[model samples]
Target: MKIERVKSRVSLRRTIESGTEEQRRAVLEIISTVRARGDEALKSYTEKFDGVRLDSLRVTNEEIEAAYQNVSEEALRIIREAAENIRDYHERQKRESWIIAKEDGTMLGQKITPLDAVGLYVPGGTAAYPSSVLMNVIPAQVAGVKRIVITSPPNKNGTLPAGVLVAASELGVKEIYKVGGAQAIAALAYGTETIRPVDKIFGPGNIYVALAKREVFGQVAIDMIAGPSEIVVLADETANVNEIAADLLSQAEHDERASAILVTPSMKLALAVASEVKKQLETLPRKAIAVSALENYGAIYVTETLAEAVEVVNELAPEHLEVMTAEPMQLLGQIRHAGAIFLGRFSSEPVGDYFAGPNHVLPTNGTARFSSGLSVDEFVKKSSIIFYSEPALQRNAGKIAAFARLEGLEAHARAVEERFKK
Candidate 1:
C-alpha cells in the first residue's frame, strides 16, 4: 500500500463496468438461447463453461446424502452453529401482516408475503466456501420463501463441494441444480424443463454472471449488481498498525479489483500501516492479486483531522468500513455510508463476513450510499391493503370524485361517484 497526503475524495468506481461488450453480448446470446432451447441450452452451456457434461441439472437426494459423508463433523457443527446465529438474527427481521381498523369502520394494512421462489447463485470459483451458501440461503429461509433453489458450477466431476451441499442440506434447501455461470442465470430467469423459474435471484459471481443478471433483471428481479470487494480502515495513532494492515489486505486478497484503503489523521500511523501492509503481503497466498489491488486502488490517506477522515469515508461509501480509533463508538455517528461498520479493534471485517449475525453480502463500489445489504426485505413483497365501509365511502366519495376530477381523470371520478349515484 502507498500513503498520500489527503486532498480530496478518491474515486471508488471502475472507469467502466467490469464486463466488456463482448461479455455482455455473450451473456445476451446465452440468455436468448436458454429462453428458446431451455434445458438443451443449459446442458450445452454447462459443458462449454464448467467443462462438465451433466446428464441431469438437479442435484439428486443421493448426492445430498453422499455429501453429508464427505463433510467433516467439525465443519458440520460449525455450520449448524452459524446457521442458528443467522436464523436468530434474521427472525427479528421477519414481518407480520398488519391491519389498522379505524372508528369509521375503514381498515388499512399491509400484507407481507414472501416470494414464490428465489434462486441463489453460488460461485464455483478456485475454491468453494460454504459460508456464501449459508449467508445467501438463510435470509430467504427466514423470509419464509416457499421455495429456495441454488445453482452452482460443478467440479470436473459435475458435483458440488461437500461443504456447500452440507450447508444447503442443513437449511433444507434441497432444490439445487449442478449448473452455473451465465447459463445458470438464464435457466433461473427464463426457466428450463428441469429447473423452475424464480421470482428473484440472489448471490454474486464473476463478470459474465454479473452481466447475465443485469440482462435478466426485468424478466426476474435480482439482487444488486455487486462489484469487487473493498474495505476502508479509519485509524488513529492509538490503532494497532498490524491489525490495520491485515484488515486492509483481507479484502484486497478477495480479487484483483478488490480495494483496501487506510485513512487516518496521523501521518505516522498511516505510514506504519502502509509498511505493515507491505510486510504482510509477502506471506499472503494471493499476493499477486493483492499487490495489484494495492498498487492500483489501495492508498493510505493522511487527513488533517478525524472529522475530515469521516467525510472522506462518506464520499467513498465503501462496502466495509473499520473504525480503529481510540473510541470507535464515538465515530459511529459521523459515518453515513458504509455497507457494514466494524467498531473497535476486535471487530474485524471477516467477523461480519462469516460468523457474524449481520450479512456478509453487502453493497459494493460506493453503492452503500443508496443501497443496503441483503435482508428479509429483498425476499418479500409488500402489498397495500385497503378497505372502506359503505358509510365511510358514501361520506367521502364526493370529495374523492372532486379530487379525481381536478386531475382530469373523469373515469376515476365516475368510479368514485357510481357508488353514490343511487
Candidate 2:
C-alpha cells in the first residue's frame, strides 16, 4: 500500500486532484454531440458504448413487470424494506414554508415548494445498487416533487436491472429510460424528443457521468460533481484494527480509484490495520479492485495526538469519516467537515449507505467543506414573502426613503415617499 506520513498541504491537494484535462474534454464533446443530435445520438451511443440496440429509450410497463419476476423475492423484499427506511428518513427532513406576524401588521415569511420535475441517474455497471435508487428517489418524493424520472443503461440484452426497476416502481416513479453515460446526462439536460428535460438531475456515476454533470450544470440542477468514493477512519488505540480494516476495504472495493485512509495516533493500530487489510483482501470477491485501490490510494498517517488526527481529518474533508475511538462522541464536536460522520465502533459506513436512512449520495473530493449530502433541501426551493400594512409602511416610509436616497436612487425613495401621500 502507498502509505505516506502527514506532510504539506500543497502535496495533499495535488494528490486529491485525480482526473486529467483530456478526460474532461472528451466528456464535454460527448455531451455536446448528444445535445445536438437528441434521440438519434442516444441510439448510436447506446449501441457503441453499451453494446445494446434499443427499440425505444423508454422502459415499458411490460419490462418493469418482467423485472419483478426476474429478481428473487428475497432481494425484492430487502429493496422494499430499505426503501421504507429511506422514505422514513427523508420524510422527516421535509420542510414547510412559514410566516411571521410583526407587531406593526407586517407579514414576513417563506414559501417552500418542490421542483416541477427531477431526473435520477442510476449507474449500470458490474453491480446494480437498488439502494442508490432508493436514496436518490425517496428524498425527491418527500420534497413533494411532482415528477421523478429515472435513466439507466440497459443490459447487453437491452433490459434494465431488476432490482433497480423494482426499487423505482416501489417509489411510484414510472418514467424509466434506457440510457446511460454522458449521453443520458445530456438527454436529461437538453430534453430529447422522448425524454423530457428536468429541473434537476441527481445520482452518481463514473468519470464520464461526473464530467457530464459538470458540463450540464447550468442547463439543469445537479446533485453534485462527484468524484471517486473515499473513506477515512479516525481511530485510537482502543479501536479494533479488524473492524477498521473491514470498513476501509468496504469503500475500496467500490472501484480501483477509490481511496481508503486511516488516521490514528497509535502506530501499533496502524500496523495491525495494514495486516488485517491484507488478510481480508484475499477473501473479498472484488479483491482485484480493492487491492488496486489500497495499493494506489490507501494509507495510514499516525499523529502524536487524537486532536492532531481530527485536525488532519477536517482538512482532508473525506466523503465518509468514521471516528472509532474509545470516546467517539468526545471528538464529534471537533469535526467541522465530513460528508457523513460515523461515530463509535458499530456505526460503520455501510450502515449509512444501506439502511441507516440518510441519503448516501454525499459530496465527494472535498466538496463537503462547502456542499452537503442530498436531502429534501436539494429538491425544494424557498421563496421569501413579505407584506406590510399601509399603516406599517407609512410608519417606516421615511426611514426607507432616506435609505434609498442615500443609495442614490431617487425613484426608489419617491416610490416609498408617494405611498405616504395623504
Candidate 3:
C-alpha cells in the first residue's frame, strides 16, 4: 500500500472518484433497452451476459425444495440462525404510525405504511452471497412489504445457487427469477412480462448494477448508489498491526476497486501495518485483487494526533470505519461520518459483513457523508396526517391563505379561504 503524508482532504476524494465513465453510459443504454423491449430485452441480455438460457424467468417450488436437499441440515441451521438475528435487529427498527391532537380540535399524525412489493438483487459475479439475501429481504419483511421478489443470475445448468435459494426460502421470498445484471434491475424497475414491477429495489451488485439503480431511481426507490466495498482503520501504537492488516485485506478481497486504508498517529505503527499487509497477502487466495486495490485506492497515512486522525477520517467518509486505538470509545464520539463503526480489534469488518446484526450493504465512495446503510426505513413510507376542527380552521386559515397567496398560488389560497367562508 502507498504511504502518503497527511496534507489535504481532497487527496482522498480524488482517489475514490476513480470509476470508469463507461460504467455510466453502458448502464443507461441497458436501462433504455429494457424500458423499450421489456421481457425480450431481459431475456436477450441474460443470455448474452450471464450465459444462461431460460424458458421461464421465475424459479419453481421444486427447485427451492431441491436446493434444501443440496444444503445439509447443519448449513440450513446456520442460515436460519443468521436470519433470526437479522430479523431481530430489523424488527427493533420497525416503526408504528402515530398521531397527536391539540386542544383546538386539530389532529396531526404520521402514518407509516409498507410498500406493496420490493425486489432484491443478489449478486452472482464471483460467488453466491446468501448473506446478502438475508440482510436485504429480512428488513423488507420486517417492514411488512407484501411481496418480496428476488432476482439472481443462474448457474450453467439454468438453476440458482443452492445457498441463495435456501436463503430466499428462509425469508419466505418465493417470487424469484433466474435473471441478473443490469437486466435484472431493469426487469424490477419496468417489469418484464413475467416479472412484475416493484415499488422499491434493494441489495448490492457490481458497477453495472449500481449505475442501473441510479438510472432507475425515480421509477423505484433504491437503498443507495453503492460503490466498491471499503474499510478504514484508525489505529494507535497499542493496536495489533497484524489484526488490522488482516481486517483491511478482508474488504480489499471484495474487488479490485475496493479500498482499504490505515490512519495512525504513530508512523511506526503505520509502517508495521503496511509490512503486515504484505506478509498476510501471500497466504490469501484473493491476494491479487487485494494487492491491486491496495496499490490503487488504499493508503497508510500518519497523522500527528488522534484528533487529527478523526479529522482525516471524516474527510475520507469510508463505508466501514474501525477504531482499533488504545481506547476505541474515546474516539467514538469524534466520528462524524461512517456507514458502520467497528470498535476494538475483535470487531473486524467481516463480522458485520456476514454474521453481525447490522446491514453490510453500506454507503460507499464517500456517500456516508450524506446517505446511510440499508434498513427498515428504506422499505417504509411516512405520510403526515392532519385534521382540524372548525375553530382551528377559523384561527389558522387566514394565515394559510395569506401565505399561499404570497406565493402567487391564488387557487391554493382560495381553497383555504372557502373553508372559512362567512
Candidate 4:
C-alpha cells in the first residue's frame, strides 16, 4: 500500500465495467435465442458453459434433502440465524398501502405492492455464496414477493452447491434452477418452457450475466450493475493499526480491482498501517490477488485533520465506510455518502457482510453518492393512489384545465372537463 498526503478531497471513482463489444453481441444473441427457443436454449447453454447436461432445469425436492445431508448441522444453524437476523431487519422496512382523505372527499396516497416474482443469480463454481442467497432473498420475502427463484450454475456432477441449497431451503425458497451465466439471465427475463420470466432479477454473477442484465433492463428490472468490492476506513490515531490493516485486506482479497483505503490525519498512523498491511498481506491465502489490489488501488491517505479525512471519505463515497475514530458515532451525521457504515472497532465490515442483518449487496465503485444498498424497497413497487369527488373536481377543474392547456394538451384538459360537461 502506498502512503500519500492529501491536499484536498480525492475521488476513488473507477470506470464502471461495460463488457466488450463481443460480449455485448453475445449477450444479445443469447437473450434473443432464449426468447425464441425457450428451455431448449437454456439447456444448450447450460451444457455448453456449465459442462453439465441436465434432464431438467429446476432443482427437485429430493435434491434439496440431499443438500441438507451434505451440509453440517452447525452450518445450517448459522445460516438459519443469519436468515432470522436479515428477515428481522427487513421486516422493519415493509410498508403497507395507505390513503389520506380530506373533508372534500379527495383521497390521495400510495399503494405498495410486492413484485410478483424475482430471480436471484448466485455465482457458482469453487466459491459458494450462501450469504448472497440470504441477503437477496430475505428482503424480497419481507416485501411479500410471492415467487422467489434461485439460479446458479451446476457443478461437474450437475448439482448446486450444498451451502447455497441449504440457505435457500432455510428461507423456504423451493424454485431452484441449475442454470447460470447470460443464458440464465435471459431465461429470467424471457420465460422458458420450465422457468417463468420474473418481474425483476437480483443477485450477482460474471461479466456475461451483467451484460445480459444490461441488455434486458427494459423487459425486467434489475439490481444495479455492481462493481468490485470497496472499503474506506476513516480512522484516527486512537484506532488500532492491526485491525485497520486486517479490515482493508478483507475487501482487497475480494478482487484485483477492489479498493481498500485508510484516511487519517496522523502521518505516523498512515505509515504504520501501510507497514501493517504489507505484513498482513503476506499471510493472506489470496495473497496474489490482494497484492495486485494493494499495488494498484490500495492507499493510506494522510490528512491535515480528522475533519479533512471525513471530507475525503465523502468524496470517495465508498461502498463500505468504517469509522474507527475515538468516538465513531459522533461523526455519523457528517457522513453523507457510503453504502454501509461500520462504527467503532468491533463493527468490522465483514460483520455487515455476513451476519449484521444489513444487506451486503451494496453500491460499489463510488455509486454510494447517488444510490443505496439492496433492501426491501428494491423488491416492491409503489403506485400513487388518487380519488377525487365531484365537489373536489369542481373546485379545481378550471385550474387543472388551465394547466393542461398551458402545455397545449387539449385531450388532457378535455379528459378532466369531460366529467363536468353540461
Tell me the deviation in Å of residue 359 in model 4: 0.9
Q: How many residue-pair clashes does candidate 2 contain?
A: 0
**Which scores higher on TM-score, 3 or 4?**
4
- Between prediction 2 and prediction 4, the one with superior lDDT is 4
The TM-scores, one per candidate, come to 0.97, 0.93, 0.94, 0.98
Candidate lDDT scores, in order, read 0.89, 0.87, 0.87, 0.92
Q: Which is superior by TM-score, 1 or 2?
A: 1
Query: Which pairs of residues collide in candidate 1?
Result: none
Ranking by lDDT: 4, 1, 2, 3
Q: Put down candidate 4 lDDT per residue, 1-422, tens digits, no spaces.
A: 88899955698999988989999999999989999999999889988998889998999999999999999989888998988888899888888899999999999999999999999999986689999999999999999999999899999899999999989988899899999999999999888889999999998788899999998999999998988899999999999999999999999999889999999999989999988988998888999999999999999899999989999999999999999999999999999999999999999999999997989999988899999999999999999998999999999999999999999999999999999888
Q: Write the per-residue lDDT of candidate 3 for residues 172-286, one digit (tens) a residue.
A: 8879999898889998999877889999888877778877887899989887766788899988899988899899999899889888999888999888888999999999999
Where is model 3 poorest over a 10-residue stretch in terms of lDDT?
Answer: 10-19
How do the residues 355-400 of candidate 1 rate in per-residue lDDT, one tens digit apiece? Answer: 8788888988888899899888899999999999998998899899
Root-mean-square deviation of each candidate, in angstroms? 1.4, 2.2, 2.0, 1.1
lDDT, residue 339, model 1:
95
Model 4 alpha-carbon miss at residue 111, Å: 0.7
Model 3 reaches what TM-score against the true structure?
Answer: 0.94
Q: Model 4 reaches what TM-score against the true structure?
A: 0.98
Cα error of candidate 1 at position 151, Å: 0.3
Q: Model 4, stretches more than 4 Å misplaced?
A: none
Of models 1 and 4, which has the larger lDDT?
4
